[model samples]
Target: MMTLRRKLTFLVALAAAIPVVIMIGLTLKAQENLVLQAKGELNLLMRTNLAHIARDIYALCDTVNDVVAKDLDMDLAAARRAMAKCGAPNLGVESADWDAVYPLTRQARRVPLAKFMLGDAWLGQSRDPAEHVPVVDEIGREADCVCSVFQLMNEKGDMIRVATTVLDETGRRAIGEVMPAVEEDGSPNEAIAAVLRGETFRGLATVITNRMFSVYAPTQDANGKIIGMLCVGKRPETIASIRKAISGIRIGKDGYVAVLGGKGRFRGSYLIAPKAEDEGRNLWDRTAKRPDGSEHHFIRSMVTNSVAGGGRAIHFEHYPWPKPGVTGAEIPEKTGACIYFAPWDWVICATLYEEDYHAAADKIESTMTSLAVTLSLAGLV
Candidate 1:
């Protein structure tokens, strides 16, 4: 019932079709391999950037810490001289009788008070309360970061600004402003309070106006009683070159790298925020909805696990995200890599959008489908 010519045509078509199917299968496997490879590349990039930042930050912080330490010794010598006037080398931080301490009237604060001095020479402020002393201003000028001194005000554990390069909105030193005496929420401020407990604090901090990576150490007398606090700080992103490098990092079409604070005063705080709106916000508990409508705290998990790595390891996770700039539609699975930067107590993350990788595989699979249709058509003819 079949002609010899027709049967011959069928054999040729089958021969061509077998090779086409095999080639498509091989390409399909390669398409999957591409996605995996891409993911690994991004992960490596994230860590490389992390190491880069850590090196630079440690260098800067080291210089600042050394300067603060030397200044603290200088301050202790001067304060001991002033305390000798009061019949002791280690008098308390505050005086009950202001007249006995060569008292100078203070102004420019909300309420004027007697000036606190070290050795009757290094007055932390001018007659106006809002002025910087020689040492704090010199350190600020040399180090290019905020510098400050906060002396204990009372037995209530209040630290009043004695001198500082930190400014109010009007550009005057925020002298006499209280840091850890209280919080707006009526709770004890955790960061400075911890310093009051004799723990050295070194991480992200906000004193007065500048948010920065800072080190706070207690200034003690010869008797080893805590008298005041000394601080040195630097804004991590204020370096324009470093800021541009970090903000420019792109993981795959719409995916980006970000820096966050991992612990201490800045836990969950955004250091290098992707969205400007997220600046100064804590995102530890931020959540997204999965496809099944289940809630997922992906950020919480990512940061928590990365910090647990203790700056010696890396972590990977898959999470859900909406297609960037699209409404009412979200990708069900996105991949992220995170690591802890111990020097600054920072967490660095790189994330990849689902479509960026999957789109390649999907295109290959679609091509295979189209090829099958075309080959089948040729064989039927």
Candidate 2:
């Protein structure tokens, strides 16, 4: 057991092994530090992208909203008389039973058939109808967003799209459509309900083909009774220059930036994703099992934490799924940063796989193994 050659070989192997172990330990410590740093970077990336997206779209809506306050002044009585005489308000969609029954105490503020009687068809270009509404086209041109006027149909809180720069599915002017009193789910339509209460409703609302970041202001008569609603909005996805930038962001090797609608009807739905793989789908309803065998409602937790940040804070979450919006097939723990942009109800998220961040450690360990074998062979020689 104590042969001189065996003793010398053992001593040489031990010397090689000691430094390799020490070097590996040091590399691992450095890798751990790098990973912790990358997590912060991931979270920062989310907030930066979130702000980048929120700003431009918000500016578009605000600019149009501001221009409307000064330009849109309608005399409902004059509008109704002129329209009714000319057989206008002809493109109207019939409102729901809820609107027909809701007792709006200030129904007197509503001009008879006003919702059904559009003053003029302002279809992106100024054409003289019974009542001329040039602002719809003017503002739409100025800000490159949608502009429309919705006259209150009744005290039942129904509003009709009388003049609009908005186009229908077929690309013609979307006019005379009744803005319903409630959502398709029979729940109060938040934007419409807020306008009925004489407050500006600012969030996301449907503008023809998609939900847009929108602003809706109540038009009131001299007696302070709401007569109609002035609307302005733009699709966040089609926002002038930022959509491409937001969609192209990559947090790490496989990590990416994405957006989910955080409130109302769009809540639980994916607003942005790579290739639009699951856009318009509710991706937040499912629960997933984590790598640690714990049940996790990843999306719900991410959204709640982002909202809790109150628009100024950035929050991080450890999600255990490999893909965004999909449940099951747990990953090796992913970390993401999320922030809520309430204006459009978007939950902006940036995520990276935990293993990706520790790639340095893996590489170092691999290199150390090779180095250890080489050093031990040299010692044996």
Candidate 3:
């Protein structure tokens, strides 16, 4: 037979263990649910960011197309067909060759370029502060958004800024300058190439110092041959309000949202990060090795999974990132949800340290243990 002390000890042990077991079980279940909910919310955020990017691009495209359709009265389909046969424009080609394919004289007479030029000249000479040139005024009116850029390019891709809400360093419109054949990164620009080929190009591309979400549409002459391009661009900073809003979302201690560019020359590039130093870094090439000394190819795997799942929150993987301003030091075990936004080629991730979750469970356990001890002593007395 057990002594009274032994029986009391057994009861106390049982009292202590029961609630702890229940608490642990409940904590595990709650943690699972919380993680799941967080992942779902992260996926929604990724999609929302992507949609915002697409909306900016589409809005720019619509603005340019509307102006071209209403003012120029050119058929876009016929223009596309005609542009298909023109081959790529040789920027260095002789004037004779240009005249043979795209006659400047005929186009000048047919379109409103001459009128806009006249208006530009008038605006330059006019003393009246409120006097707006007719064609320039029309374009300015269409450029409703601040920081928007609208340009009419010649067949040679020389751009004339008819109206711009974006200003140069001098706070004046960049008028009558040839658009650069290449982007700031020195890559042949896909958007310009598409328009030059007489096809509409809508995508993200770098313009000047700012990476812009751009839309390039072919503007044609009376003969339905592509004569020029209508370009509308908005800097990503304009749409970065979404990122600014989401950046504050914290997932345990130091976890935050991170954005990576998924396509174009900037593919695998970091777009947004809490650490300023991490921005613009190539994520795919900068990944750390796995525990087994194998290359994890973190960026590639994340992009592939997110793309395949159509931006769904696919999986959580261990992500090792260097601590800011600390060399050779990495976060022990950080995990993140990978999601892709196809429209802007963005990879959005929300990450948290695994230890944080464990700590919460530990805290609950500690509290339960204290409660059990108090109850067990009372029963013994």
Candidate 4:
């Protein structure tokens, strides 16, 4: 027969081990399920957010195009002549001529060119108020008026440089006299060389100085010639505002949200305990070697393409997160996140932590196991 102490010890050990083992298994299973669900929800959120962003961008682009077209059709000669004169009569005649040119001229004239001009202020690059010129002068030189968003800077003696060209024939010549500015980088010729060679230019390009992101839409005129491109750029504050909005969303107590770019770059987030360095960094090209040398899991979902206003999905690999077990873990290295491309070719994605999201479930599982053990002990007694 076993000694009393040994018997008691055996019973207590069995009671504790069984519940603890069961609890751990249950907790792991619950965590996995919760994580999967959370991922689905995150993808849905991303899709919705992307749709809204695309809609707003397209609307803004349309508005800018209409505004430019109307401004170009007006009596630009009279406007310039009026600016030369210091009185409102020239201004009035100019305004009347503009009204006669287009039915929408009256409304267009009332609309400040300052609103559509690309510089810090509607003033373009000119510091002298008297030297104020229409931004159209810079826009009309291209085969198409579609040019990337650029900074208008003073080249010399307060002469502002117009970096891009516009779509008008006569207006193009006028741009030379009125603006007399050249591209800062002198690469416009190279950038549009393919288009000049009768090739279609499709894709995203950035204006280096302002770090402005724009989508170039190719379009042709009645002559089957690619006359112009429609260029749309997100405002400086757009991404910042998106980041702010995502940060405000609350998922569970520990759950959070993030907006990853189609290339799996960090765009914005509402993560708890998020890495400080990950913000505002592009993750598309840097996925193979993260600082931590850990594997990361990223979800790719097709959302919206800014340029075409369509949907597309594509997969990206070598995400930056550390694997469950990896040695020499340093700060998470930048890696390419996965992207989902849909039929429309828009991409979307998100990242999440499994443990953080299922904390509540883990606690609940622990409590239940403890209660079950207590009841088992009482019955044994």
What are the lDDT scores of the predictions, listed in order?
A: 0.61, 0.61, 0.53, 0.34
Query: Which regions of candidate 4 fall more than 4 Å away from where they truly are?
Result: 1-205, 209-224, 227-234, 248-256, 263-280, 284-348
What does candidate 4 score in Cα RMSD to the true structure? Answer: 14.8
User: Considering summed lDDT, which 10 consecutive residues are worst modelled in model 3?
Assistant: 94-103
Please, what are the lDDT tens digits per residue for candidate 1 over residues 1-381? 889999999999889788767766665566557656665665565545544554444455446556544654454444334335533223334442221111022233343333455444444354332453556656655565666766766666766666677766666666666655554436565556767788766655665545566667676656777767776666445433454666677765787767777765456777776665666688777788778998888787878888899866667767776654578764556666677866556677766666666776566656655765665565445
For all predicted structures, in order, the TM-scores are 0.63, 0.61, 0.53, 0.37
Query: Residue 296: error of model 1 in Å?
Result: 1.6
Model 1 residue 124 distance off true place after TM-score fit, in angstroms:
6.2
Ranking by TM-score: 1, 2, 3, 4
Candidate 4 residue lDDT tens string, 114-229 = 12122222323322323434433333332232343222112221111232332223333112111112223232322243443455333323232122223432223334444333
Which parts of model 3 are misplaced by more than 4 Å? 1-137, 145-203, 235-237, 312-315, 325-330, 363-381
Candidate 4: Cα lDDT at 22: 74
Q: List the residue pairs that clash in candidate 2.
A: 89-118, 119-131
Error of 2 at 305 (Å): 2.3
Predicted candidate 2 versus true structure: per-residue lDDT over 1-381, tens digit per residue:
699999999999899788767766665666566656665676566446545544444454356545443332222223333334543333234332212222223132322352232444322222233334555655654564667777777566877676776766666666656666765436677788889887777666767547665678776644566777777766445442444666787766677777777765566677777666677878776677767987888888878777777667667777665565556665566666677766566777766676664665566556655665665555445
Weakest lDDT window of 10 consecutive positions for candidate 4: 90-99
Which wins on lDDT, candidate 3 or candidate 4? 3
Best candidate, TM-score: 1
Model 1 collision count: 0
Give the runs in model 1 whose Cα sits over 4 Å from its true position: 1-117, 120-134, 138-143, 153-158, 181-201, 235-241, 290-293, 323-333, 367-381
